[model samples]
Target: MKKLIYLLFFSFLTSCSSFSEYSKETKKGFDEEDRTMVSNEAANLKTITFGDFKFATSQKEFRKLNKQKPQFKEILFYAKTTDVPYEYYVLHNPKEVIKNESFTYKDTIIGNSRFVIAVSKNAPRQDSEFIKKMVLSLR
Candidate 1:
């Protein structure tokens, strides 16, 4: 009984820490300015696709596609609630696949629509700029 209780506590602590890390990284994926600029861009889209991956697709389908793609490394996958509910994925390419050290991919589902955003490590400002451009292009 003691061993089972200890195992449960340990698991709880680790999961909490993992969520903290995910929340931190998700915040890093974008910023207030980007949010401000792209405020309504996503509102009108029925489908969002980036490369071969489409956002808001079934999680099972996504995993299958990711498995077929050799270059991408899936970092994390989780669901969270902000103003609305969404599923978020963090992914990266192997060093050989992308020469840049700071590159990262953030795929998410906002409501029923899927969206993908790319960010450079430690570059939240650039994240805002990139989203600004993406918003413009989407419109």
Candidate 2:
């Protein structure tokens, strides 16, 4: 009976430790992917500013827009309707970027409910250039 109890306790302890190790590995995998995505996107940045927000896009896309109208009509509409300032509309692809839990930031929904604007006051310390641009615009 004593040996059976010891075996059960040992099994339980090992399971708990394994679970924690698994969780850590999973988190590390996510962080690595987030870093890669941010690096790639930031390298491709072609940006335009409206209010306090900086909009990022590929140079190819930026050239297609009518310079006068700026086709940010949806964005403009949301900006006018919401109490939030234009600068809050910083990130281009908010959904993907928001997955990085390491970066601390705030967000507001805008643009016909299709867009989210990410705001961060602290200078970005992480490798995400997109977040760096967002923080810089706050200054």
Best model per TM-score: 1
Q: Estimate each model's TM-score.
A: 0.24, 0.21
lDDT scores of the candidates, listed in order: 0.33, 0.28
For candidate 1, the per-residue lDDT at 19 reads 18
lDDT of 1 by residue, 44-79 (tens): 222221222223123343444343322223222222
Which residues of candidate 2, in runs, are more than 4 Å off? 1-56, 59-89, 92-98, 118-139
Worst 10 residues of 1 by lDDT: 19-28
Best by lDDT: 1
Q: Let me know the TM-score candidate 1 reaches against the reference structure.
A: 0.24
State, as a TM-score between 0 and 1, how close model 2 is to the true structure: 0.21
Ten residues in a row with the worst lDDT in model 2?
18-27
Over the stretch 1-139, how does candidate 2's per-residue lDDT look in tens digits?
9999999999886443101111111111113233312111221222222233222233222234323222221221111112232222233333244333322444443332223333323323342235334322211
RMSD, one per candidate, in order: 13.6, 19.1
